[model samples]
Target: MDGTIAATSKTDARGKQKDKSPRLRKRSGFVFILPWFIGFLCFTAGPMLFSLVMSFMNWDYMQNMTFVGFANYVKAFTQDPFFFPSIRRTLHFTAFAVPIQVVLGILIANLFNKKLKGKKVFRALVYLPCVLSGAIYGLVWNNMLNTDFGVFNYFIQALGGEKVEWLADPKITIWALIMTAIWAAGMPMILFLGAMQNIPDHYYEAAEIDGAGGFRQFFSITLPMITPTILFVIILQLISSFTVMAQVLALTGGGPAKATYLYSLLVYENAFKYMKMGYASALSWIMFLIVMGITIVLFLSSRKWVYYEEKGGNI
Candidate 1:
């Protein structure tokens, strides 16, 4: 009886130690991430919470805040004339730019995947534009697309075509911006190339063995396999497109007639240029909601289209 009791005590102590081991490890893990947690709370969550509160007030930096409680939001929706136009312009740019970027990225990535001569050089050249500073990109394009004495206009004139105002004409300015966006498809192209290379060679070989042609194999195998990367790129590009301000600021400065005033640019103008802090905060929250809604819709829609290899099915 004494021996049995001693053994039972030892076992219980061992079990207790085992239980404490996990708790200790968890505490250590939390300690390791404590700095990041504190940073997020102080810098990210704190500011967002403050912004939410500010959105309800009527405050300029020079005066005490007045608690308006949704007045700013109401004004933005019903009173502000530029609000809707900015939203529309942002949406217009996003709609035109994201799809073209995705398609071009995929096409270029496919070209890079091919075992062709000087492919490395071509790949590097394609990726070069993505590294250019946005301000520089905008300035360069501004000069190149100028109506008179621009490189593009010179080429058009040489080809016996009329000089077109690429940036000045409101009708074509957005299109020109879209063209500029397409040039920076290098990031997505590289992602797609990585995804393509990860696909097993046997799959292509099997498709060929089954009498499948190149295009058929690409559509049926390559596209479906790379759908996850496509979804990721689409979400990122969508967010970036909506928040685009630097290029517009550097190139058009909200345009000749405010035709290129994106939502983010409008926010910037209100925040800094006009010093309407409360109103800008409200606008930012509205833009946040819009972005969240669109992202949620995309995620929900992706369930039918995005294929997950680990899950062995579409997600």
Candidate 2:
């Protein structure tokens, strides 16, 4: 009888320990994460909620705080003259810059993957631009693209070609910004390289055994295998291109007759330059919605193209 009682107590204790273990672990995890959670509530979530509330008001960075409901949103859609133009400019940048960045990144990654002398040095140089601050990058490129005594113009002049106003020309300023964007394709290049390295060598061997050439192997094996990485790069580049700000602010200041005036510039100008804080908040939410919409579309469309090797199917 005593033995049976002791056994029951042991079982109950074990059960209690099992239940308490997870609770204790959960408590520790919460304790560890408390700092970040508090920070998010205090700084990020608080500010975001504040901005969302301000979007419905008519606060002009001063004493005014009249609630105007959907007036700001309606104004952005219909009354603001720069709205469509800025949206167009931002999308134009996205269309051109994202593809070029993806292409350049892939090509550079492929080149660096090959066995070559000083490959490590070359890789470092290519990724150098990504580590640079946006303002510094703009300042560097500003000098490089200058028509008078700039490196680009110096080369053109050397080849008996006329100096082209890369930034000063309204038509060319957007292209110049796109050029800077292309130069910053280093992060995607690194990502592509990592993805390419992860591809199984046996697939390439099988392709070679079937009498496939280099291009055939790349297209049939490498490109298909890396479609997942390509999708990731595309989404990242799209987001970056759409929300581009510091480079334009430092380089042209949306100058040359507002040719490079992007959507982000409009939001910034309204918020700080013009002191339309409420309107700027509305614009910000609109930008978030646009980006969220595009991201959703990309994710939905990815089912068609993104390949998962482990799953042996498209994502």
Give the number of the best model, judged by TM-score.
Answer: 1
Model 2 stretches astray by more than 4 angstroms: 1-21, 311-315
Q: Model 1, range 262-291, lDDT digits (tens) per residue?
A: 899989989998999999999999999999
lDDT of each: 0.87, 0.88
RMSD of each candidate relative to the true structure: 6.9, 6.4
In angstroms, give how far residue 27 of model 1 lies from its true place. Answer: 2.4
Cα lDDT tens digits, model 2, 84-182, are 999999999999999998888888888888777898888889999889899988888899999887898899899999999998999999989988898
